[model samples]
Target: MNPDNAATMVAIEIQQPGGPDALIPAERPVPSPGKGEVLVEVAAAGVNRPDVLQRRGFYPPPPGASDLPGLEVAGEVVAAGEGATHLIGERVCALVAGGGYAQYAVAPAGTCLPVPESLSMAEAAALPETVFTVWHNLFERGAAVEGEWALIHGGTSGIGTTAIALCRLFGVKAAVTCGSDDKCAAALAQGAAAAINYRTQDFVAEVQRLTGGRGVEVVLDMVGGDYLPRNVQCLAEDGRHVSIATQRGVTAELNIMDVMRRRLHLTGSTLRPRSTAFKTALAEEIRREVWPFVESGQLRPVMDRTFPLREAAAAHARMEAGDHVGKIVLTV
Candidate 1:
């Protein structure tokens, strides 16, 4: 690596909120790791829906975070702050608040997971954001256990595919919704118990049919708005509804009496704004529960495409196009 590149790195930044064109390349000073953090010379970064939202001006980085748009990265740790020296020279993948778009990004030591030799830099880069979100929302908050059934929306998306893969590994059955038949097929190929074409079919009715009218035990919803009430209809008695994103719209109207009558549970979470202590705890839990699958090569991200770091705009465009089947990544 060039010594000057260690001091200055090429990063993609949003010049102004609009479209993919808003993301522009620029030279930025390499960020230094703080106490309990490690500085990664990033090899690859994952592109997520949040990155697209940030580019469109809908989502903003949390306070004290880099304005650059990236959530997860995989690379080699070259420098470490206090209490993090042990991680130096280790290949790690991490979930970050922001700044993952740069060549060098600082990550909390606790959030960095060791990258096994079985996975490539691009594949490792794709794990953290989706894995953390699914583990927390599906298993932890939703209380989905083995042998239960889960309904996941956006089946071809990074989160949906991760959820499907985890459900398959953990013995939970997953039924996913997609916009097209091809996507539905893709979801089925990814180990989903069933796939619903939401664009042409009524998912609530389909879920009922698939479960023999008993409905699903859990619903992992990404499309909120009117989908909330519809999602509730797709759940069984004492079912859990976990919302992770509001892709459709935020506000929704629901029948409270119905919720009460069915003994239903509703919950949601956003990972970026959470405290470092909370994220660290989550990281540890995943390291224990899910890392084994990753290390053993039994689990891997379903990759869609990879773009050069300088062409982040093209990556954003691909995500927005909604034609991709899995994770979109940026390689440095």
Candidate 2:
């Protein structure tokens, strides 16, 4: 918050809407956190799907957020604004709208959570975006319950892996679908009760067989083309279907009769553009309901690899390649 200490920091900027090479490293002024904010000396930042979209000039930062290409980071709080002074010296992992691919970034105080003592800075960096998202959509939106079956698509993604771990830790029965047998195996290893290889198996049929034709109580999906109607058929009576992303295509023509016949509840959300108060409430819910599982060692971050902060373009390329298993991180 001090003008004198607002030094310049190296960051990756999107010079234009293009490919990974468009991510150009440059120096930018260190951001000063406003009221109820904290200045993080970033140790590491997570590379997410949204970042990839942002790099391609598709997803822009939310209103009033930085145009930088990062959504989450882990580091120590070097300074705090007005009412956030208590967090000035604490180490934390924070969920942010942007500006994380750097040595220094600003985050809202309420979006920050203490980095677990057992986690390294890199692992901590991988938690915020995926964790907040999984907790929000799966547990909160899906209303996944103990002993109940939940199906997650893209079972090896950051969201999928985190969801699997949280489901296991919370006693939810998980059945996930991945692109390959290897990723399917990885999903099962992460505690999914069953892993379906979408490349080889019919996930709807598999889900039916896995749940004795009752179907899963909740279906978490990001793939939203024909998967939409098929996902509806994969749900149980009165089931909840929550879609967080549409990796295939956005618009889907659904049979209203099918939705009504199954009594399916359809929903979806995007985190970055949300209000700070909304994110603050989600953070509080995570602290109250999810922190214990993290502390008890039931949840651990699964990281694929770490690239230096300046090599953010490479990280984005790797993510686009879709070969990595878990989260890709950028270490400063």
Candidate 3:
């Protein structure tokens, strides 16, 4: 539980960007907390899609960010830099720009949320990236409100499940698209109002049918490429389309006339590469608005599995295999 004088730690680094095997174990000097940061003795770190992309050499860490591939971690704060001393002894889950695939990592004090007694280290580790993304894209940028319906792709993913849970909590209905019937059922069980097996059904038509031809108020899309035009078809007039990731492909051709006529809004964001001040503000807003549900045990990240930190390659392989139904974590 102590990090004092721990000069080195084990980290999973990308030996080369290619495949799961690219992630390799290495010895690294334990990082120090910079001003307004805390050194966390990591208990668990969340494995995310971005980590996979990073491993494949498609995504790289932002400048000044750690090259190691991980975005979130849950741990005990063992040391703190000048302005962050107050967090030195707290249990926290933080969203980091990088360097989470290690036994210890430095995190911005502002991005760290207090881990409540109700949450396990693994579950806490799973929250930051997905929760922040969903909250920002679905509610803030998309402007989804109570009683509205949202269409989310990747129903079984960390982002999808977190979006469903948050939608349920906030009185917004979520209809999700999954690759399989089983994943669809899982999404329904996780509180999605409807789940479409995209592999078997036409999601655009199904969405139209589900909403009785009115269409949903928002579309939370991660699958880009061809899905973007179809997603636009699934939206109601003035509906918002928020793109968080481009899993399918990056390019898409949308009907500008349709967009203009329907008054649909298309917007997307990448959470990394954003300024520290912006993330800090976002963290504060999430703490004030969303932490209550977490503190009350009403919100928790859906966990699929946990792997040992050294088995990070296997973890990435599991994610790429696409059968996991929820968040995956690397236990430290």
Candidate 4:
């Protein structure tokens, strides 16, 4: 583990975006930290849906973002660049720009957060991406408040589970939709007020029933398209629906009448495309509002599985399977 050694590292690369087979293992030089960044000896990296999309070539990293496939990682800082005074040799979990799929990754100093003492490296790796996304969408954009009702699609997902836990901690009531009974039970155990099995029940109707026909105040949706119209229908007046991904479909026949009648606001965003300044602000918010909960053991990341770094392709395959209850990690 000499800092000066240019170690051979294995990374999952996409030769041609298509399916799970596209994620091929390759040997490459370990990257060095640049100004205001730190080079981490990655202990673990989280496998996210965006990584899967990137592998398929449907989504490419934003300009200056990492060309490799990882979005978040937890590891020990092996080296720090100029101006990165606080992070040398520190164990941390960070929201990465790219390059997380490798054995080593460089992260901006400001986006790195101290790992909770109680968390495993695998759990720490799982936190940054889903926690950041949920915080940004639910509290920042959706303005989910105490006592307000929040609806989340894919309730058993990493983001969904994180959102449900945070909402419970903050006194927000959450109703989530999952595909299976076991997933519903998992979401409920994580503090979702109600869980609807989407395969067996109409989520809109179930939400209506759960909320006493008033609808929820916020909706965090990843499945777009058909969910779009029903998301509007399941909103209270002035509800905000934030779409983070279009797993279902992008386009939808929106009933403008529902939009006008409910005054619902539909919005969406991607984390990688945001400027460093924006990401810094998000980091600050997490530090101020969320980190304490993590530090105190009130909010813990849900990790369902882990794969060795060399098994990154298999990790991606697991995520694509869509049966996982929480985050998946690649242990380096």
Who wins the lDDT comparison?
1
Listed in order, each prediction's TM-score against the native is 0.98, 0.97, 0.99, 0.97
Return the TM-score for candidate 4, rounded to 2 decimals: 0.97
Residue 293's lDDT in candidate 2: 72
Whole-model Cα lDDT of every candidate shown, in order:
0.95, 0.91, 0.94, 0.89
User: What is residue 84's positional error in candidate 2, in angstroms?
Assistant: 0.3
Residues 108-175, candidate 3: write the lDDT tens digits.
Answer: 99999999988999999999999999999999999999999999999899999999999999999999
- Model 2 CA lDDT for position 229: 87
Q: How displaced is residue 171 in candidate 1, in Å?
A: 0.7
lDDT of 4 by residue, 75-134 (tens): 999888899857888999999878998888999988999997798889899999999999
| Prediction 1 TM-score vs. true | 0.98
Worst 10 residues of 2 by lDDT: 1-10
Clashing pairs in 2: none
lDDT of 1: 0.95
Candidate 2 local distance difference test against the native: 0.91
Ranking by lDDT: 1, 3, 2, 4
